[model samples]
Target: MKKLRLAVAVIAAAALCPFMAKAQIDLGAKAGLSIPNLTSGSSSNPINSGWSSRLGLDAGIHAEFHLTKRFSIQPEIRYSSQGGKKDGNQGFAPTPEMAGAFQQMGQPVPPYLYATYKSEAKFNYLMVPVLAKYHFGFSPKWDLYVAAGPFVSFLLNGKNETSGTSQIFADDAHKQPLPFPAVDFTRDQDIKNDLKKANFGISGHVGLAYHLNGRSAIFIEGGGNYGFVKIQKDAKNGENNTGAGVVVLGYSYRIKNK
Candidate 1:
């Protein structure tokens, strides 16, 4: 986490290198949504879930160091809430490719995979991203720009819950809680212990800004962030790598030169 913060700081400083003569330091805030899903390791269900409509809220403050007429460095620290859930039958149907694999394995056709485990997890984080933006001012008061960079997230808190039957584990089977498709796991299993603690990812940002009189501006940004960490830890000490996506929209104040 310290390394991530240091990297952002370094990038922010570098953004200022070219502008040391006449510097413009600006700050702003933003908010948005995060949509995420779980990927299954089962060859029968290789891809976990896709595009489930879950929304997350994001807000951040950024400082941009203008170094030249067209270049600047922006460093940000933000708070984000992101997660996803797979419901038994709420669009959680397995894909044809998955179904075909199950058929090949000679597994019984499920009435749906309410027989499968549907898990939902929530995550909160403090993220820092250093981005390089190109500013093209249409007039002396307004400008357009684009920025993209890498980001790191520190996992603050998370919860994992599941409702369904899964036989992935060979320990024991208790079907009283859910009777759909008898999952072969015992009640002694602790699902929460199987989740990841940190995440590393990338973000792409594009937005327009309007200079409000002095050094403040209101901006709206829409972009997607893709995380490369598996939200889950291995139940069998194997490997698990799942990721998350975020779409953001919000307003901010640019506190530097217009």
Candidate 2:
């Protein structure tokens, strides 16, 4: 994590080097919705596979330095909400008792225990993205721009929350039941320890801005982010990647150079 952080800082500093002396710098803040999902790379691992998008909060503050009339460099510190959801019947790892019962009968243990419930894996991350932005001025008051860059994220928190009342079964066919009592899947489990702390990814944006004055502009944009690495520390948990689609509204103001 320290190495990742150092790399991001060095990259941002390198991007800012040439423009510092003359470019106009703008400071801004934005807030919006994040629609995040986990990509379950394999179907065979039922315990950590099959998930859908979940709503989350995305917000950030950034500094943009204009390098030319149409180009700029922007580096940001952002908070991202990520993860995915699964509903209905899902698989759980078998317990010791479950494995022993199958063993006593001279039967091989099944890979998972079947349960009908809902699971939402929630994650929070602090991200930094250094971007190259280009703007098209259509009018004195309006401009359209797009940006793309690589980002690094440090995980702040992660939790597995489950909720439902479902029968536990030793097989997907529901013919075999475990001896455990009625199962209740309703609790938040801290999963941060099971995940790596830093992630590397890509993020991009496309939007339009309306200049409110010579020093300020208001804009709305939509963007997306995808992490290149798997999220789990142990391969047995399943290989899942993180990503999100986002929409936000923001305002930027140039600082006076006096």
Candidate 3:
């Protein structure tokens, strides 16, 4: 998107601005675990509600400009795995054939059908964040730091994976079935078309680092990102937001300008 590109350009310009002033720059790479959840909007739609977290992986590289000993600016590009899963009885739209069959029996087609199933929605994204970081010194070899900033992300892919089988139900509350055979539910549903291309949000972290030498150190950090925008392009597919918590182990090397 034009707006996302412009924002990225601004961040890149900001990173380069410190070069003329002879600032310290650090390059780093990190890899870690991601725990993602889909926060649904207020709705009775089963697709929009009742989601649980799924485990995935995340990784990235960053360039850090030291504006001062205690403060710095860091820009990062990261890959995030996000989405949610649900198991057990869930609701779905009724097919025309199902409605016709039920209608002939003097039974009106309910608004939806219920079945026991398993579903997992996985979404992949490429994210960029411009962070302001501050370091706190408590020991000669270990330092603590915190960083937070705004980020923009682009969706690379999305899908819904479903499995299991159950008899069709008119109502889950009363355990009423339509006297139908058990239906197979295993399938991969491509959801990329249902999602927006670009998203913007916030990212932050609290980290502790141990200095291996004067130039390089290893660190462990925990943080999270949340999308301010809804992911679904259609309200009918379900209104949901992308969010995840991340923990990473990373290494950084400083290129000191002496």
Best by TM-score: 2
> How well is each residue in 86-121 modelled by candidate 1, as lDDT tens digits?
544322244375567567878754423333456565
TM-score against native, each model: 0.65, 0.89, 0.88
lDDT of 3 by residue, 1-258 (tens): 989988998998887696625778889999999999999767776668878999888999998888888888899999999999989888777778788888888987777788889999999999999999999968889999999999999999999999998888878663787777888889999989989999999999999999998899999999999998889997767788999999999999987754
Candidates in order have lDDT scores of 0.60, 0.89, 0.89
Tell me which residue pairs clash in candidate 3: none
Clashing pairs in 2: none
User: How do all the candidates rank in terms of TM-score, highest first?
Assistant: 2, 3, 1
Candidate 2 displacement at residue 223 in angstroms: 1.1
Residue 108 CA displacement from its true place in model 1, Å: 17
Q: Where does candidate 3 have its weakest 10-residue lDDT segment?
A: 14-23
Question: Candidate 1, which segments miss by more than 4 Å at Cα?
Answer: 1-22, 38-53, 89-118, 163-193, 235-258
Q: Deviation in angstroms for 174 in model 1?
A: 17
Candidate 2, residues 113-192, lDDT tens digits: the string is 89889999999999999888999888999999999999999999999999999888877777887766777889999999
Q: Which should have the higher lDDT, number 1 or number 3?
A: 3
Q: Model 3 segments beyond 4 Å from truth? A: 1-21, 95-111, 172-174
Clashes of 1: 4
lDDT of 1: 0.60
